[model samples]
Target: MKNINNIFLYSALFLSFSVFAQQGKQKKADTLFNKFSFVKASKVYQELIQNNYNKDYATRKIADCYALLRDPRNANRYYKSVVKQENVPVEYYYKYAQSLRGMKKYKESEIWLQRYIDSGGAPGNNDFTKNVNFISSVFGAKQQYFLDKVRFNSKFSDFGAFEHDGKVYFASSRDEGVSTKRLYGWNAQPFLDIYVAKAGTRKNVDHTAKVPGEINSIYHDGPVTITKDGKTMYFSRNNFTKGFEIKDNKGLTNMKIYRAHLVDGSWTNIEDLPINGDDFSTQHAALNSDDSKLYFTSDRPGTYGGSDIWVANINEDGSITDVENMGNLVNTQSAEGFPFINAEGVLFFSSDGHIGLGLMDIFATIKGDDNAIVDIINLGIPINSSTDDFAFTMNPNGVTGYFASNRRGGRGSDDIYAFHREPVLHVEGVVTNAINMTPIEHTKITLYDENDKEIAFMHTDENGYYQINIDRNKDYKIVASQNKYIEDYRKFTSKNLQTELITIPTNLLLNPVHDVAKLAELKDIYFDYDSHEIREDAAKELLKIIYLMLYDYPDMVIKIESHTDSRGSLSYNDKLSIDRANATYNYLIRGGIDPSRITAHEGFGSRQLTNGCESDTDCEEADHQLNRRTHFTVVQME
Candidate 1:
């Protein structure tokens, strides 16, 4: 019995020791994760899961690690384990949805995304849920860009291409041949440095070399923009500069934008920008066309997300002021950074917050007439992928450019890729009435391809103007229609088109149905003296209207008005005119016209005389005969 008790005691001691050891390991893994060391933390979390110690928490952490590392395949695998577990946080559902999207499982991603939304996961001001068909629309769009990986890419991260003076400048994590190699803990990669090479489209040439300057440090650096004169430079670097490092309260070093001057063909005079903060990151500097404004990414106080695009006015003395956020239209509740402003002032940036195919997708800003950002358009496919795609830089020609992506088949974790943009085709015109030449507002415009398949549709603006993007070298049909008007169908071909934009010179004209109904020339039906019955001549005139309403315009509606000559007392004439109008209404109904088509049948009682036929006045008998008649007027036509 004593031996059995001893065995129990030994077992308990061993169990207690194991629990303490596991707790210690969990604490260590959490510390590493907090420090942004996802690669190391992931391994530790996997070990904890193998020991079955706090398996749920460890599983979630492992998934989070893979997600931060942009490894959606592994993240999806691990997230599947805990997403269905009891009491799991709702955010895991959102993360799992993102991972599925990274794998191009868009339908499955939508299901999990719906579940996340149903579970009360707040997505802020983004309209992902509102636009349920956005994914389909994105995939349905034409391919805009063709990409080719640059040959200089190493087996490490090589991205952020910027062009100046016929040379391509970029950032890379390749070995620098320093005696003591320093590495970033996030992905176990070497510190980033600036490199330069001759700018060309050739795939076999590799003339990459480090920038000839003291710009590099033991920490992260590079990804730069130079002024039009090639005298001033702005770049991103770790907070460590001037032989010291600045860290936030969490002991994490943030990024900062620095300025440098080019002297005698070498970059020097390095200085950090005043907009940077020790507690937050401010990097990825870009300049507008005129160099009067500087654009950059920052996570300072007023940001709507992890980071947001910010603009500052450039002073005459190479300083910045009047910093402003780009607003919610360009930023969301997730990360947005790497802004690149083109010559036309179009803002291109990368975001994980907006609706995208996966982790980080590139987007372009659509500005209003006031130059405020009104909307954002996804750059869709080839330019973006299921992984991080950012640091887009466009050349002056606008057709050819470079961007970076960590997508599949890359030579490294991230690679710089040259891209050629295909020319886009657009058809624009105004819709107007054929008879009166008046602009027809709210006309429905539909576009159909050669296969007669409806491709897109929209309503014309208040000014009767419409514009639609079409595919090059394809036959298309545009149909414009409005209420009470005949539809106008115009077929055109974009085949062999050389220009990007074409304005249809001829306005789309819709003929009003009322104009066509006028062919009936509805003559008045006269009545004999003191008679409220229809004559043969009256029946002949009524048949014209009946035939048109039944065979020509079945949806037409009309009203009947009857008048009497001034021969009897006012009350008698009024009663007689009403009976005449009612007779006409009944005749039309009996002739197979829908009763609802007759909007009204009323008597004027000699109030609307066609001539001076009052009882006190001497007028011709023909004028009196004209007064005793029933008239038809079209009220509505569909």
Candidate 2:
């Protein structure tokens, strides 16, 4: 009796163990399929189907895997099968919706998108936002202006978009990106890819996903963008490729950027991006809003971390210039990449090093007047998250932008999404002369992008003030030049400085060399405020005059005069102006102008207005400004 009882117990234990083993194998198969390792995972799922086990999870995962592997036909087929099974979770609906979109079944895809949203699935991750706007953009060349809101949102993550002719053309890998296959693993799903959609409008959910095919290849493929002329396509790809794959000394794979020129209306030949074959990885390319410059990301040497964004010029020959490090201010110790240059010179990039809500977040930086690159500002919370978020592409129009994020949930490893918003650029400043407090009249200023190409030129009015109208997504070099002065310069890096940023001071203190030489015209001697003091400005002018005297004649001497406008009494004005002239004499003495050979002090109160110019009573302020002036002839130079 004891032996028979033991046998019955053993039989029961064996049955339980068998069931558990079958479930483990089934779960493992589901995981493999979700990881984008479809080739092997498919075999497991097929076994489950043959063995007649619970195939719902396995079925859904297989469909998602096919989509990630860029095999739309199979993915679409399986996704349909999951829906037919009925009572599918909202996530399953989302995957099926994407699968249909991949097949260009816009109507069906949009229906599923609606269903998913209606089923308590929120927006903000990969498929986080509405799809109406993206759908409309797919049929045209312009879309970026509509996607800015999604890109600029403080908490949303977006990327993988394309832009053209003032339009945004890109994608976002956000919401629901944390699938079982990507996070915390060795064999993670390399699931980013190329997708095209319109910006700003109510994007159709059916417009959200596509077949990918040659466009999305393996791993990741976009924020796909074309030059304004629409002659070339620029985009980013991840750790692996379809054909060319190389290993470094460390045995690690790096991302590479590629470009294809639109020849006769079709992208004819694709080539690797120049400067992208460095030891590190590189991706994402954005041309300046004006089409004069190009920006991108790379983990090349000199970067702050995993991948700091770098920029280079798109030369007239269509080649890139040597890469310039954006520096500590814009890049942090973590990964910082994906830079977008707006027309107004404010640059946007992604970084994980600086303070941010995620592993990587977007940042902005402003350029200075000296043509120097400044640090980047980590775009805070609204657009960031505790997850990995990056890849931003922008256009000046109020339409679109591309960004990426890995948030709560999504179909594949990371699916690309789309959207739109307004564009922005900022610039402001003040202008003054180099030697004196006096305002410079009609100071001409020219603005150039980082590539040294001219963007704007203006003249300072009587107030000696000028301001630049900055277009977002542009870089500029403000070159201030006048007929008698050396060039004064200001640099707007386009990353940090924006609207109402500190008023850029237009103080033109160009070297006095040009105006002080023998052949050079001596504009005038200048003095400090109210005190008639021979200030540093005065000294700078005197040095120039002294040098001219020495060069023209080894020994020369002269007198200096101080004049005042008709604002004071005769005795007081006369004595005051004399002392002012004497101050000039003392300044020259200290400036190596031999005192023995020079004499100073003499004031003609309100007496000197140039001939032919109107009198102070009837003339423009020019006459009075000239009246209250300082003058000095060639003093002794021994």
> lDDT per prediction?
0.78, 0.56
lDDT of 1 by residue, 1-638 (tens): 11432453465455546655765687677655543345667889999889876577789888876665556798899989989777676877877877787787989988987898898877643234454333223222235577855778888888889988899999999865666778899999998999888887454322247786767778898799989988888989999877899999999999999988888878899987899899999999999888899999999999998999999999898778999999997899999999998866778999999888789999876554355555566777788888999999987656567899999998889999988665434566678666534466799999999999998887775556566757677988999988668899889988865332333333588876767445555788999989999999998888767756764566788899999999888899999999999999988877778889999999988888888788898887888898999998888777
Error of 1 at 607 (Å): 79
**Candidate 1: worst-modelled 10 consecutive residues by lDDT:** 132-141
TM-score of each: 0.47, 0.38
Off by over 4 Å in 2: 1-158, 165-168, 171-190, 200-215, 238-242, 398-402, 408-638
* Residue lDDT tens for model 2, 390-480: 6665434423345566666533333333434322222434344444333455778778888888777777654454555465555567877
Number of clashing pairs per prediction, in order: 0, 105
Instruction: List all candidate RMSDs to the true structure.
Output: 24.5, 31.0
Task: Give me the overall lDDT of model 2.
Answer: 0.56
Worst 10-residue stretch by lDDT in candidate 2? Answer: 135-144
Among the numbered candidates, top TM-score falls to 1
lDDT of 1 at 138: 25
